[model samples]
Target: MSMNPITFTPIGVIHSPHKSKEGTPIQPSRLQRSSGEVEIFSEFRPGLRDLEGFSKIFLIFHLHAMQESQLEVTPYLDDQTRGVFATRAPSRPNPIGLSLVDLFSIDNGILKVGGLDILDGTPLLDIKPFIPDIDHAEGIKVGWLEDKTHHFRNHQADDRF
Candidate 1:
């Protein structure tokens, strides 16, 4: 298939305590109780209607800080080098990032979220409600990550890319 270039206008920005990726948690699951704010642009405020009801929301953002792309990466949880698509390394062709965070409340055009693992001032591309009935799966195969997730809570991101 032919590849096509796509442009995305960020609708918002993410605000968190993490100023750099070096010490940031690699995933939301690694940072319990972490809090952050999502400030939706005024023009997109209307799209957030009824979003407060959801317990979790998927924050799709751009990895604007990723300076380069890599095809193979040594994942944070593993020592083996693997294809970039198989890992969640920030360096990618598109540099798009996604995280499922706990939705606390929506006040005005800002949303309070928990367990966020994104960097401060990250561009927010989109937000979607997470429904367990449709998003969660049973007997899911994690491939190489099967037995390596036990220590995610203590792992921190480094300047590997």
Candidate 2:
């Protein structure tokens, strides 16, 4: 087996009030009132045509500041160590973070968004509109997440990353 190397250029930057990770919400749902902006590069501005119709968009980004990856971790809101894939902790092998944020509006290439849990100045890889009919699944199982549902809103990332 071989590992293939790939490269990417950030389309733009994410502007959020969250300058640090210490007090930022661990999930978008917990930060409904917080607002942010996505500044898509001028070259990619044309790609956003008709995107305003969607209420939310998925942001795929790199955990730029994360130093390393781990296979097992004690995630935020839980004391037990679990396989890294089972948790949303940022320090994964890929170090990619996905956030489904609310789209308030779009003017030119700047998108007004809210409910962002990502760090300020994170490198964005791509943005995809969230369509409920296609993205939502019924009768799904959450595995270990079932017991941690109640703590999601209050959770904050610890040093586990």
Candidate 3:
């Protein structure tokens, strides 16, 4: 096998109230219901044509604030050190992040979204409609997070990573 560097041009920018990772939510929270805007670049505005119909969307963006990567990390919700792949730590080999947000409206190239957990000025990679029939699952296990998720609502970004 061979490895090659891959490059991507950001499609847009994510504008949110989260200016720093220190206080940003680790993930999108339906309870918090924070609202923000996704500004798609002019060249990508055509892709937003049918996006308004989606009630929710998945925002794929670069974790630009990450300082480094760790193979093992103490996840925000737990004290045990675990493999990075087992947790959603921002400092990863690729530093990519995903958020499922409620889509309220789209005007021109700006998208109004709720439940945003991403930091402001984050580079948007892609956006996909969240089709419940396709994205929802059953009989799933969350590993270490199974017991830690109850504290999700109270968890916020810290300087651990």
Candidate 4:
């Protein structure tokens, strides 16, 4: 088998108070008070049209600070090692992080948002409005996470990842 390389150019940068990976919340739901801004490039400014009507937006970004990739990792919240896809660990085949953030406002190309769990200066790939009717499901299976869901509320990103 063969693999082909792909390239992606960041459309923006996410500015957050989390300068380092340590001590940052592992998920956006845990970072209720953390605020940040997404500075979209001028070329992508037109994409923000009519997005303000939504209460939340999905931010897809690159884990720029992650040093290496791993297929199996012991995530921040758990001591047991799990496959990369099972957890939101930064080390993966593609270091992409997705967070649903509150849409405070949009001024020109900059978007003010809250509930940020990403590291400062993370490269932004794309943004999409959160539409409950389309994105939400009535019943979902969380697989191995079912047992650990209770602990997620207080989980913070440790140095494990």
TM-scores, in order shown? 0.95, 0.94, 0.96, 0.93
Give the alpha-carbon lDDT of every model.
0.90, 0.86, 0.90, 0.86
Predicted structure 4, TM vs. truth? 0.93
Q: In candidate 4, where is summed lDDT lowest over 10 consecutive residues? A: 23-32
- Higher-lDDT candidate of 2 and 3: 3
Question: Candidate 3, residues 20-125: lDDT per residue as tens digits?
Answer: 8888888898787779999999999998898888998999999998989999999898888999999989889999998889999999899999988899999999
Model 3, residue 139: what's the lDDT? 100
Worst 10 residues of 1 by lDDT: 25-34
Clashes of each: 0, 0, 0, 0
- Over 13-121, each residue of candidate 1 has an lDDT whose tens digit, in order, gives 9999899998888889624566989999999999999998998999999999999999998989888999999888899999999999999899999999988779999
Model 4, 40-131: lDDT tens digits are 99998998899889889999999989889999888775778899898888898888899998989999999999888889999999998898
Q: Candidate order by TM-score, highest to lowest? A: 3, 1, 2, 4
Judge candidate 4 at residue 88 and give its lDDT. 80
Off by over 4 Å in 1: none
* Top TM-score prediction, candidate number: 3
Regions more than 4 Å wrong, model 3: none
Candidate 1's error at 59, in angstroms?
0.2
Deviation in Å, model 3, residue 138 alpha carbon: 0.4
Ranking by lDDT: 3, 1, 4, 2
How far residue 19's Cα lies from its native spot in candidate 4, in Å, is 0.5
